[model samples]
Target: MTNKHSERRVVVIGGGIVGASIAWRIAARGQRVTLIDKGEPGSGASSHSFAWINAGAKEPIGYHNLNRRSLEMWPRFATALGEDVGLRWGGKVSWETDPVAAEQLQARVQQLQSWGYPSRQVSAQELAELEPALEIGPVVAAEYSENEGQVEPQMVVDACIRRMSELESLILTGAEVIDFDRDADGGIRAVQTDSGDFEADTVVLAAGTDTTTLAAMSNVYIPQAESPGVVIRTTPLPPLLHNVPVVYAPPLGDGRREIHLRQCADGRFMIGEGDQESLAEDDTQSHADDLLSRAAQYLPGLAEAKAIPVPVGWRPMPLDGYPTLGYTTETPNLYIALTHSGVTLAPVISQLAALEICEDVRADAVLTPYRPERFATLTEEQVAEMAHPRAGHR
Candidate 1:
């Protein structure tokens, strides 16, 4: 399809992985693209992300399908960017020890299997064979999905930005978007940033947590929940297991927390807790210690691993706990891209968003469920009703 706005100027706000991907893709299509960020690119949520590239545990079949499609596109996407973003597709291993949680895990695995997803329950022996380093304490059930993976999110963003520079796309840092300049017809004509105003035919708000604030400048309301999360990075250690991501949800009691751990390409292990207990405004030491202690139970190697917590960051989750993509009705030229799994969805979302913007085609068929208009008239009760069970501060 030929883009009607092939020669138009595009300004992408937010230099994280998603914005960098969009800017690079648009520039590749022969458009004049500019990328602006309030600080260094990928220093926000993208830097501190768990960076697990997976579709294994996503709920609502449609969301899972979207993630699966993105996982399929990641390899080519990484290759095109021409750098190692620490992309590893060793898959994932997860288990539950409690009977109730084990039953839930079985049902979830069955549901995934019914959806044609390559996920299956594994026996204790199979689990051992998959990850020898893990000490499965009374594992009632376990599963392994060969389709999951992980990435170094900061590396991906840096690679995309480097390619964007090679493409001669303008990149501005420390330029905070303050407002939008609109024409009489209510179409965006330019973006007003703290640095200055830049003219553009289209403006994309890919800023993670700041998306809502920017949308309001164009008279658009994008409701987002405040979900803060932290990731603890340990010093580089010997290879743990076979380079696979491991998720363990032990029996819930005595402050035991769900653990997510994966070794980066550089040999450093990234660990995160799934709990949402709030911490002191400036204190993450206690939380980091809790996470390391919990992980040490399963992997004794982590017992003495020094815990270095990454910067605290918040996920840009919509009210319904799903991605919000596509343009707005009030401002036709203003586009939005927000989600919790930014690392997993960056490539595909960027491709689809670029198509919609350049070709003047609506991707409603594929993105209908995640359109931003759903929250236009969304009521308080409706938001409460749509709250996801797993949706928490993180």
Candidate 2:
């Protein structure tokens, strides 16, 4: 393995939010760093996401805690980047459209409260008072978290790339890393790219869905769950939904999907995840109208949201529907950071993982329980046996 004590040269594959953030953090610590992207930085799944920095959205107290840590780091990260990534901390409102969903929402509120995050239920009257324009359904209940927020995904990538370059880190665009070569001792030496051979003391694969292919190059199989969802941006409207806004409708239980409606700072309200389909691969974009049609069903107010611009992307879904984050057991220097919540946790993970790489520490201890390698360790039989342990696992 390359000596951590020696001056290090690190190459990060995939220049999305995670990769760029990692490169920025590593270079900020005075290390030699290079970030390579096949296309433009953050133009991939990073920029295509909902762009919400929601700490309380995660289920299970552990996920919430991880998000809380990320939440604490976000302010410092935004200030350090010193650019307006359209970040807003106006809080979020999550709602349900079924009595059962209301019960579940009540339970989730209790869970969030137990974790010391302030989330409380709001009545239909309170909900109406909060947003007079919102047309609540017959079975609507809401839980509001005051600290949640959103950001423009593209702006975040732009700021991080500029900051990484300013920190003197090599930012390589349009460089696709096709393969990686590891020496006899299991150390990554050179990454074979379309351009040429690029060498580094360490390699971190934050390649989003492509991480699976890169790990396969290293003979490691990482389980991936891909979900294709739609996001529609409406024409800029008046500040209809105030603060960090979100609306949720319960699953009809007919194998359809639930809804998470969000309004962005740019006067665009994005409706997504109403017709969740389990994605087979991350090879193609999804059909936008399928999701948009579903959104129109949940939100009667959406009929008036004009000129909706639709975009579709895949969120890396682990088998458990939670994020799989950590380094591989077979390769010490080969690190993996795959999560749908990358936007929310980009700054935190970058800061923590950079500390681990630069300081010779394993910050993976924090997220070790959720390691991608967990799937690697399980036999095919085991995975088949334990599939879908939790309802609405996402």
**Tens digit per residue, CA lDDT, model 2, 1-394:** 2344437888888888878888788877777788889999988887557777776767666777887788778888889989887777767766777778778789888877888897888887776666565566655678777787777777777887788788678888898999887899777889889988888888888888788788888876776654665565666666766544656655655676676667676777776554333332222223344444566665555666663544557665555666666567777778777776788888878887787778877765577777767787788877665454333344
TM per prediction = 0.93, 0.86
- Which residue pairs show collisions in model 1? 227-393
128-202: candidate 1 lDDT, tens digit per residue:
888888877778888888888888888888898898888788999999988888999889899998899999999
Runs of candidate 1 exceeding 4 Å displacement: 1-4, 249-255, 275-283, 384-394
Estimate every model's Cα lDDT from 0 to 1: 0.82, 0.72
**Model number with the top TM-score:** 1
Deviation (Å) of 344 in candidate 1: 1.0
Evaluate candidate 1 by giving its C-alpha RMSD to the native, one decimal: 2.6
